[model samples]
Target chain A: MLKDFVKNIGYDDPLEIYLSKLEKLLGSEYGISKRAVSLLLLQEDEEIFELVKKNEGDKIGVISAIIREANSHYSNPLSYIISERRQGEASRITNSVMSVKEKGLFNFKETLSRLMMNPFIGGPILLAVMYYGLYKFVGNFGAGVLVDFIEKRIFDAHINPFMVDLVNRYLPYELLRDLLAGQYGIITLGARYAFAIILPIVATFFFAFAIIEDTGYLPRLAMLIDQLFKKIGLSGRAVIPLVLGLGCSTMATMVTRTLPTKRERIIATLLLSLAIPCSAQMGVILALLQNKPLGLLIWLGVIIGVFLFVGYLASKIMPGELPSFYMEIPPLRLPQLSNILRKTGSRLKWYLFEVLPLFIFASVLIWLGQITGVFGFLVKALEHPVRWIGLPAQSSVAFLFGFFRRDYGAAGLYDLKTAGLLSGNQLVVACVTLTLFLPCVAQLLMNIKERGIGVGIIMSTFILFFSFSVGYFVNLVLILSGINL
Target chain B: MRKIAIVGSPNVGKSVIFNNLTGTYADVSNYPGTTVEVYRGKCKIGGEEFEVIDTPGMYSLLPISEEEKVGRSILLAESPCVILHVVDAKNLARMLMMTLQLLEAGMPVILVLNIFDEAEGLGIDIDLDKLAKELNIPAVKTVGTTGAGMDILRGKIEEHVKRFC
Candidate 1:
């Protein structure tokens, strides 16, 4: 019935001309309306064109001519004209049925939502959120206080010693004892790191994230930062993955599927793997640079610079049109405390379950490497590049640990910083280098899962070289400038 | 078996309606693209069992992203008995264009004006019966999150299937 109404509206003349051209050029009986197919073809919609071109081989020329004739009738592109007509009809129909009631204003929520999207005010608001929610709350309170209570009071003071004694008593073999209770042992190191350090940091970060997300601040943040992002070949929507990358890069890489274009996804994935350090790394970096503002700034500058430079370069190198950005701006509301807590708890529970096994596996791998002397050999190989970046040979262990888990490298760095092995400048360089390092094992696997293995391997190799090279340059520049922190 | 596929852009209460219809868990969150995979369950309306498919959010039939592709594929292949184009009532103007696209594709679409409570609070009131007449398809206003107007929606769905099917 609707088709009859449309047919009676006299599109038949233009459509018939299109069909004849289609039949003449393609010579097939696909019977699909040529005008619609031609319009789709004009918009460079590949799938329909391929279908029509395959079926209507000889008549394709006629279809082209008909499309050309229709094109000539409008100054604007036919696709745009067609879509506008459809949209106009939609609006006309909607207008006829929908009415507006004059009511009291929702002025308060409107004003607050507006304030969040305003660049001038939103910038400072963002910083305040980051400072309190992330730095002070997550870093200082969760990582500092909770980690100290768990790692020192519970594990170091009690569990490690108890586990060592138990292993020595039960497992008489030296190898088994070392595997379970030594410095790199599964029980002593991995379990501790997973529960004591990573758990608290992740829990806090998720708590903060939930609050921010529930308030609908993220889309507003995206809108606020859209212009700055355009310079880096991304739009505001990319900010979702980037910010989530701070929580977990592996998850963020999966989320990059939301990006409209292949180019955008690759760019986002690359930026995520290189510049955006995950929550674990961020916590350790924050702790490492807690008192060193200069070091923090230098580290921040290097990562941001690499993120922009590489993103710009990737956008140029990748063969695709840049995607236009359009996203809905959601209204902001006061976050419910219970919702925030529940979300954070669930997320933290998920994170812990995922990371605990990996952490233990990493520790077992390290133990195996140590027993076989492969760990020493790999560290020796890493020493060359370590020296190139002016970092000590021992930092190779952290870099080695980094391949297994970013948080492990961060834990290594934290240990190093505590031992007074690295100076302020060295700490800055290490944090910058490690933060820009390849994502953890899970992220690597996820990248392979999302993008093919070849792409994943290529991405990892590029990140490894790029991160170290950037570190080398930063160190060189700092040395030349003689601004020793 | 008959099927009703709920389709729309993300975060427009499709999941809420799906849950209300099927009484299943779908992890309804306040974010978009959370429902990445299609979820299907049974809905019994008027002593008739219908399968309800909750698709990944999609902006249009012309897909640009993976999730949208998933949503579009479900529509094209499954050919549901009724396509519930669930859209945010507050953003009706922008969203109705997709409704137009769905109708143009000759799919059996029922326009669901979701989040109508919020839309009403924002001063918008939709005349559902009039909208049904204009679009030549069933139109229902719902606040899915709160289960408002759900009985009417079910009634409309049953009536639509009885007449059209």
Candidate 2:
């Protein structure tokens, strides 16, 4: 058996003597070797120490004394001393077997990798990537082109009409027919949004995200952004979850578990919920603002301002140790097409399964509320705020849809746009408010699950008021300035 | 049936190797920290069934982040029959330290030099036999993406299981 001749990583003579002495006292029943337990004890691993204490009664004091003695022998911690010795042995073995052939010149990947992390060069590169990958590809092609084809040519022209006609002819009960295919029906609204609007947008976003992921560009981007993140009380490592939030905030909220500090996790979660609109909502917003470049820029400016301003305030409010950043910069490589497609396919499958049912469920709930007249009352209540923000009363319906899902609300706005209900100014304001609106039901559950219920509720409440307040202000500014946009 | 657990630093193709061995897919990406949870699948090796575990990436026995803690917990608690210490071939020296720690723990370890093609592209040549002897364990070269060297890896796993398990 391999354990018979376990490779003994040699430490200093005193440390080795201490290790053997500690090893003599440890219980033999541990899953790992006694020597490893002793080594972990010497390194002051609290969990291992507790485990040893639990098993080896009466020997705890002796182990503690020996660890202290070992500590006295070294200025550095025993963990560093042990790891350094292990590294030395590793280097020795690696040197004995590995050879590097020197190249002449022009290491293109190395050069490009450096450029990617360089502060002066990295910003523009990041912008260009966003412009092309997100704006041009996901926004224009996915939301604009693909969404138009699916929503207009397929769902609106073919499926919705056919389903409504079928329901009208076959179903005797008006309520049942309305639930199936009438206004705010499951097939007409929910299935249409899921299949026609969200599908293409999320699929394209995941494809672009997968390609970016496989190219090993994220770490470099992280390093470049670390300084800015530090100011916001997050390490460069937080970039992973924050970036993932763009695809889906629910998953990204779960991914925050990877962060080292609770402070960082909470901050990251708050930002994801409030500012980082998921791909589906973002796609709709981009499409809404596609013809108005100035409006798009203003929307971008306000959301970014809110992101930084809120982050800075949160950092100041929370008391914790500042996060330190460290991440591995894997070498840049060409992404394999097969792998990219597989990843995109799996992500799309996951997104659809997670979202499709919710969309349909939201429709059923809305239909129920309508039959009971509760939906009209809620929309009427919402109309007050909707009008205060200078939006038409019809916009209240979209605001109500916003609670089910951010993208659902945006999809409502899209319907409004197609109906020629909203003006340019109203469109931008609606987009901004919806983008900063409450996280969806799934993300809310995730927030409570990841962070405790208290923090999750508090965050949601703050976001609920802040979003509308910001909308009100944006609308006020637009009216006062008389920009008409 | 015995168990085979694969552990490594993030993005070293542990999931890829796990998929190859188990004939199932786990999320494999170039970026680190994707596999934040454990993945388990069944595999048949040399007429023997094995439970193969794909763990979150960890740097060393001493864990810092939450995922690393999960990785270490699986190793120290589950006690698999064969521990595949997967490492990136391009960064052998830095990664091999964890291999040494795994060995010191007296776990049954097989060093996997994954991403072997990329290392070769960078003009780094590894003497695999010497690496095996130097570490006093079987070492396998693998391109996890393409499943190269997988047969030899399976052979090595079968040999280890027959001898130890």
Candidate 3:
């Protein structure tokens, strides 16, 4: 049956010649059919060649002879030859078996897919997606509405006051009670920031992300941005991690492994950690600049400029050949509402579970630090640098919290914003600095786990210095240019 | 016990098929590269038990990335009894290249045309028998998300192992 099938296909003669030589050398010990194995061996299949060489050491001469003979038969490598044959056969079979009726209706989905890939129309669509999906929906609805409800109505009105009073009453030590209830208290501050502020923003971002992802819009976005990415030595595939970075940079760092080259991965990781503001940071920045469109644009411009400049610089510094990018574009489909909801729910649950314990632990640690007066000392130390950046000394705590989590610092900024401690220029500078600051503790640990401790620490240190330096420069530039908001 | 390795390019529903066969939850997503790690489970078929291995996606045998290296290593090391080469039906031309590579590797391959419903919706009509004959292997169409053609796949697996093993 196999021989008959092989004969009908009509590419059996050369394969047969190769197989006969292989079979004669190995005899009964060769378990695989000689023809199939020879094709792989000729293709420089290292694993198969190694096994055959190990088992039939004496027959290496004959096998090499057959490989040379096969090589002489094709100008291209044997792998290409074999693949072409197989593809030809596949297409032949497909043609024989399948018949198409009249062409179906013009698909709007395909047209939309094409439109999304066009640089002209697609650029605006991309901005629209970011503006509405991210700015209007996630920023305003999530951070403004949901966060306000949870942070103010729920935490401040109910949880914080109750926890502060309960702690003050039960704890005998004034210091310990103050640690649990006073400023930077575990329940009153840390837990409230995590659950009430960060959770709502991340949840909304993931929901929006799920919808966009399911609609197959991301790959189209990738295609649209490929030219821009080429300048940075990345391909459309890098877009996956970059987009996800907007949701969570730690996850994006891990996803960088999918990039075809190590250089691409490193560059991608650097950009993600340094420039791409995760959803929490983005939300807070949006809220901070909600009333100042010019400030928001400036903030956006600085981050984007840094992303491109640094990416371009890194690509030049990193020595490697650029990887060619080709991705299969899956047909666009209407995202099923149920699937989007399920994805959002599951991701939210996962995010909450992963973050809640960390937040609680952060609170307890802060409480201990406060009792030991370490928190006060660190805040005092940070105050000078905060003032140097032109931010008020009150911004010191936010910078410290920024080390724990970027979003934590943004939550601190939210508090400061509410208290009216920052002007328009100060808010812009602060946002840019925090956006470029060190990765959160969780991301640091994740980076160490994924990329090693040395690399992670180096990246973090680089980011810390770079962020403040950029902040200082931006402040200088603003003053020098005499741009007043 | 025998072993069956589920292998395919990224996001072709390999994990879903693995979950369907093994009764396990491995995070399924529309995005690729979700299954960065290998997963193993057991299933009973035709009064015999088998070990099922799920691997990361690879576009070709000649690997370019780390994940593909992991996938290719699994194929080389395990020498699975039956290699299930899962391909998206809508992408028959592109995916068949991998199927061809598997067959060339001299592994006992079962070609799984997954996402058949999507192909049908696109008005693609595949002649399964013709394809099977041309490749000299069993070809099965499956809508893995909905458990369609699963029984036929299992039955083919049993039949192949009985005849070949």
Candidate 4:
């Protein structure tokens, strides 16, 4: 019944003629209808071709000849013609059974949805969303308020002193005592950062992300940004992973697989590695430049500049087909509180499980580095770049912490800021450099996993030099221009 | 156990429907491309157990992206006892293209008009029985988020599976 009806619905001219001929020729059972098989074969589906070749044997030659003849009948590809026919039939059928009531041409949600995709309006709406959702909520409330409450009121005032006292009094061995209570102790630095700095910031970011995600705003953002993205050799579809990269680049790297082409995937991965700072780092940077509006502006400008500059260069250097964009924009819906909370909870769980160990492990490694003098040596080596970037010698420790995770390094800078070690210019330069720094260890491994080991290493190496160079240039510009924040 | 596979374009609430059927959370989101892996859980239809598989989203039979490849492979390899072609009701005209492809493939398909609430809110009304008769398949309306119309969907799934498998 289905095949007979579909055949009657039919494509124009020779395609319909070719389909019947191929249907008769494809003798083997393909688990699907012969008509469907014929259409696929005509469209030159690689998988279906191999299947038909295995099943049809010598008869494939005749089928190929028929396909060639059909192609001659149409200027467009057979797949396009066939798909158009299917779309026409679908619409015809839908019109028969589905009806729409007369109403105001643009409903509230529909108008908002349209405005969300308009270039001028959408861009400003996006900034407002980022300003309120990210800067105010995540940065001010999460990183500034909640972090201060946890890091200072709880961890610094209470937990660290309690832990150090407990460890110092009970621990017998001098080396063990220092390892547990010293500068880079797991409880002192690692656990503190995980719970105090990273936790609040990530939670707030995820909450904001979940709300925006549920509102169906991201796809509209994708549509709005498509023209810009096409210039970078990525389609609007790349927005999903890029936006997600703000939440966490490691997960975003995995999401890049969703991009249609390998070239798009590689470019997206490289951008995520080099430019997109995860929520933790972004929040901390926001907190660092909270009072210094111009410093924050400079940091924002530099990061966006690097994102576009690197993406443009990569798209040019890498040889591949330019990406095409097609995305389904789901209707805008009110953010469901349950869904938002559950999403945030699940993501936070994933972050805690994936990242907490790394934070503590980094602390242990730092402790080891200190004991073995390797940490001191690395910090010393990093100090030269730190000087070049116009940051303090102590800032080298933050840069080293950055290698573990971008957020951890930002957290290190937060400590330095609290201690009043860095000037406004140094804070801006460090934030700019650290934001563009190599992705965290989790993302590093994820990049290697998603891209091959070779590409991942190349990307990391490129980002390493690029971030520092950008930092050096920013510092030089601030000096040369004689404009200090 | 026989299997029921939920397939659709991305972000059409396939995972939410799967969650509704299996009573398991599959990370439902408003955006597309969330379900990167196949999720399977158990449910009972007509007093007989069935494995419900939630696949990554696919637009058509011909695969393009990695997610679509995974989805297309599930259809080819698993040979599900019943295929629920879950579609967003609001964009039925566009989404029905995939439904036609699935039907043309000669698989046992139930056209699920998911997100029906949204469609109705958009002042759209679909004649379910007429649509079913036109396509020569059973049709059901469902609001995947609130689990509305799920009982009817479950009834249809049982009927489709019992008749086919």
Please tell me which predicted candidate would have the highest TM-score against the true structure: 2
lDDT of 2 at A253: 95
Worst 10 residues of 1 chain A by lDDT: A1-10
Error of 1 at A468 (Å): 1.9
TM-score of chain B in each prediction: 0.97, 0.98, 0.98, 0.98
On the 0 to 100 scale, the lDDT of residue A252 in model 4 is 86
What DockQ would candidate 3 receive versus the native complex? 0.37
The sequence of per-residue lDDT tens digits that candidate 1 reaches over residues B43-138 is: 999999999999988876667788788887676567687889999999887898788767655667788899787788878878877877777777
* Sort order, lDDT high to low: 2, 4, 3, 1
TM-score of chain A for each candidate?
0.85, 0.97, 0.90, 0.92
**lDDT per model, in order?**
0.80, 0.91, 0.82, 0.89
- For B1-165, candidate 4 gives per-residue lDDT tens digits of 788999999999999899899987787777899888899999977799999999999989988888888877777777787889999999999999999898878877888999999888879999999999989889999998899999999998877766667
Which stretches of candidate 2 lie above 4 Å from their native place? none
Q: Which scores greater on lDDT, model 1 or model 2?
A: 2
The positional error of residue A310 in candidate 2, measured at the CA in angstroms, is: 1.0
Model 1 alpha-carbon miss at residue B123, Å: 1.7
The model with the greater TM-score, 1 or 3, is 3
Docking class of 3: acceptable
Superposed by TM-score, candidate 4 places the C-alpha of residue A146 at a distance from the truth, in angstroms, of 0.3
The docking quality of candidate 2, as DockQ, is 0.75
Instruction: Give me the displacement of residue A341 in model 1, in angstroms.
Output: 4.5
Evaluated on chain A only, model 1 obtains a TM-score of 0.85
Q: What docking grade does candidate 4 earn? A: medium
Candidate 1, after superposition: displacement of residue A469 in Å?
A: 2.6
